[model samples]
Target chain A: MFEHTENINNEEYIPETYIPTAVSHGTKELWQVFWILLGITVVDFIIYFAMGASMTRNIIFILMGLVKAFFIVGTFMHLKFERQFMILMIVLPALAFIGMLVFGLLHEGNALSIDY
Target chain B: MSTHTTVTNTTPTWAGGRSPFNVSYGKLMMWIFLLSDAFTFSSLLVGYGAIRFSYSGHPVTPWPDPALVFNHFPGFHGVHLPLLFVSLMTLILIISSVTMVLAVEAGHRKDNKSVLKYMLITIIFGSMFLGCQAWEWSQFIGEGARLNENLFGFTTEAAAKAGNLKLFDHVHWDMAADRTPGPVPFASLFFIVTGFHGFHVFSGIVILVVVYINALFGTYERRGHYEMIEKVGLYWHFVDLVWVFVFTFYYLI
Candidate 1:
């Protein structure tokens, strides 16, 4: 294990001047993700206006939403850079809970449906 | 003493060590907080869906169509622009998220100038989004949208036929069954969900401003890392992500 105290005392480990990057691979990657998200949103908008409302169309919209969400979470949040366990620990549980909410609410909605 | 020494717990549980998850503790905690907040938002949205969809039981219930209600754009009076303004709002938020991520990336490289620049842009974008939302809310209120009741008529046909009916005319209210709870659930849910989201956006803007000031003052530079930017970037992205769902549920669908 690296010792923080030892590292603090090590002159070689210390950089006297730190200059952040104006353009780096990470920035380029961020732009790529941004464009992709923009593309997805535009497609979703086109679909939204071009097509009439239908179950299939709604599902497609939602799936595209999920896709956009995945990218934002993976890249913007930088979850992809984290350990897999950390990713799963945060994502899986929240997803499971959200799934529960969707299903449970769907059931409730049906129960409250006048047709029912 | 035994010939072979037995090793007990070598490190105290509270003792600091390398991050087990290979991420900073502050960043990890922020993620956890965001996850919990995600649950909070999901619950609110689900509740909105349940109540909003549940109104299917009533025939003459009035639920205003989001498309028709949100059609007005700034300086375009009487010109309907379905999803245009809201879409613009989404784009602005996404752009801000992009700037925020850029800020984080700059932080990673220890580029204080870039971090400050990107963070400033992010804050500007966030503030613009909030301004748009405020305008949107005013439009809703100006158009007689309410949280507790439906000012619009119940059925367009009924309202048209009955000249005395003030609430549900074709010139005003769209074809929705206005009875019982009427548009109460819809209005309340709209206000609640979007209001909560608006609060989050406002908070994000404030945080970004604070972070921007810090960046300007060489706070993060002195700390030798831009982890604050990364943490706040996570929050800003989360806000944008929630808006995606909100736009879908409240506007599109």
Candidate 2:
């Protein structure tokens, strides 16, 4: 609580060491983090326009997308700083749903009945 | 039962000057709520994916081409502008997240002015995002756009082969066009769920404006600190995170 602000005359603004990532806190390299974010976005754009077969393009994008997502969630969202149990709680359901999605998308075309 | 008081540690002032990332209780609770809200949206979308599975078959309706649907932006002609509006929405959300962080910074410094400034910016961005969605909904639901009525009738499966354009524009109504839809089906579900999420963003903006107003009046200065900013910021970030999934599953897919 800042109950002592009135007594301190608000003269001293406490310098907070902002923590965005899970890494050990020290001096912040703000520019470094910004550069990384910009770089990843550009790469994503490039991959979208790159001339490649659908499968190849999709595979590359998926992998790169996961990496980018990890950076955003870990650094930007600060989820990386959370406990392992928190991580599992956040990730497990998504993984499960994604598995079902992939399976249904791939197999249903062949497996679905046509009697209707 | 969340209190707005900022945490005070008895471990002296030498410990990294009050951990910003230590995260307050209110923020954590907001996150937990957001997580539950996330599952609700995903279930709605994934369920939409499954039930609308054979869009090409049954009472076939050609869906509208989402790209071709909103290709105009007041001045542009034939822009091929797919995903443009949504892309801007994504950027706006990102920028709002940045502003929210700035507000949190201001809260740490006990600077009410900067706190109000950043919170106002966040409110403005949130409103704009919702406004964009309103435009999209108008363009989609207005003027004969059907969830199940295409030129091909029930051959939507075949129509889907023609491309994403024809698939979106066409829809096939089960009973008669005049008959009321029975208990809100898939298309209804899609709009309702995403609409509800957008409504949350809308409400969050209102709450943020109230918090900003309190900050402007120097309310927090009187009684300790402004943890409301932190709580609201968490909600803002959660909104951003949810949009990522919505963009991926609903729009991109």
All candidates: DockQ = 0.30, 0.13
**Interface RMSD to the true structure, each candidate:** 8.7, 10.6
Question: lDDT of model 1 at residue A28?
Answer: 75
Q: What is the lDDT of residue B33 in candidate 2?
A: 79
List residue ranges in candidate 1 displaced over 4 A: A1-25, A114-116, B1-17, B152-154, B158-181
True-structure RMSD for candidate 1? 7.9
- Please report how far candidate 1 places residue A61 from its true position, in Å: 1.3
Model 2, residue A87: what's the lDDT?
66
Please report, as a residue range, the 10-residue window in candidate 2 chain B with the lowest summed lDDT: B175-184
lDDT of 2 by residue, B56-170 (tens): 3444233333343444342443344555566667677766766776776677677788888878888888898898888776655653334542221223343343244321234
Give Cα distance to truth, residue B120, candidate 1, Å: 0.9
lDDT of 1 at B21: 52
